[model samples]
Target: MIIIDAGHGGVDPGANGHGVTEKDWTLEVSLHQYHFLRKLGIQCKVTRDRDVLLTPERRAALVKQSGAKVCISNHYNAGGGSGAEVIQSIYSKSKLAKQAADALMAAGMPVRRVFSRKGTAGDYYYMHRLTGSVETIIVEYGFLDSAIDMKKLSIRSFRLQLAEEAALAAVKYSRGVENSLYVVQSGAYYAKDKAEKLCEELKQKGYEAFVRRMN
Candidate 1:
């Protein structure tokens, strides 16, 4: 499972350009990603489902409580940049976040490096600071202040594509594909003993089996 945070909201409109508010776009993209992940059977939770402002500490708490392995915060850049940038926590390996950046690039969004904060060897965002226990990444979708970037961000279809690509990244990250093989799902049971019994049966049948706890 993953926790996604839509950066800025309500009074904190974030960066603005071309008559579009950053908060609105972040929510749209985050919500779309959440929907796509759910459709793919990937469990996910969002910090805010609507136009509400949440403090960084509050957001961090939510992510921790969700028991998500990863957290992604969505935002837009400003000042003068014309592409996408993925920022990861300093303590994180950044494997999943880089995969996400690659997926975005493949989906037609420009790539502007996946990196950590300047000077410090850790994440600069408050959410990352408080939620360092979990791998956290902040995505600057594109530069809202740049005219070139604005052209792409203004397209609704492109936003949908971004959402789809982001969700695909989450799915890939969760699965951790290392080999091509067959998978047999025995069953999904709420009780631990039932799952253990099923695994034992599969083992007796000469099949390698294990139980994965899901949220």
Candidate 2:
């Protein structure tokens, strides 16, 4: 089973920018992903389904108790960065993190990076360090402080798409299907010229890239 965590709620509103709170956004995406997984017959659980508070310790305890293999902690970025990011434990491999990043990229979100951070003890985040053996992934969907990100995050459909794509990635990884084939697209563009421009850039970097029209 997978555990979905909506980061920061109740008293902790998390980052606030452009009139949106990080807690609400995280919860929205988590709820969407929870239902999507359920509909697909995938066993999953959410940390919080409403605007209630969950201490970091409490959240970690729930994840450990659930005996879940994977825990996806969803949070929105802030402090002025563009694109999405996936953070994994320093002890784990980047396979799952890469999958999550790729899913966000496919959903028209630029991926900043997929990497691990270390604390003095173990993993930098409590979700990773305190969650026992569960592979916890912290997904920063987009930066609320970034105009580029806000343009997309402001759209409800776009936010839902991010949640759905992330859920699909979690399902694939948690099921032990790590070798699934994936299309590596840099980003989606409205203008054909812009798409071609990015395609050329990738090709220059020794990547065999092409621009494909999405119907």
Task: Name the top lDDT candidate.
Answer: 2
- The 0-to-1 C-alpha lDDT of every candidate, in the order given, reads 0.81, 0.89
**How far out, in Å, is residue 209 in model 1?**
27
TM-score (C-alpha, index-matched) for candidate 2: 0.82
The list of candidate 2 runs beyond 4 A from truth reads 178-215
Name the best candidate (by TM-score): 2
Report the lDDT tens digits of candidate 2 across residue range 89-177: 99887888999999899889999989898889988899999999888899999999899999989998889888878888887888777
Question: Per-residue lDDT of 7-79 in model 1, one digit per residue for the tens?
Answer: 9998899998888889999999999888766644578999999999898788888987888877888989888
Q: Candidate 1: lDDT over CA atoms?
A: 0.81
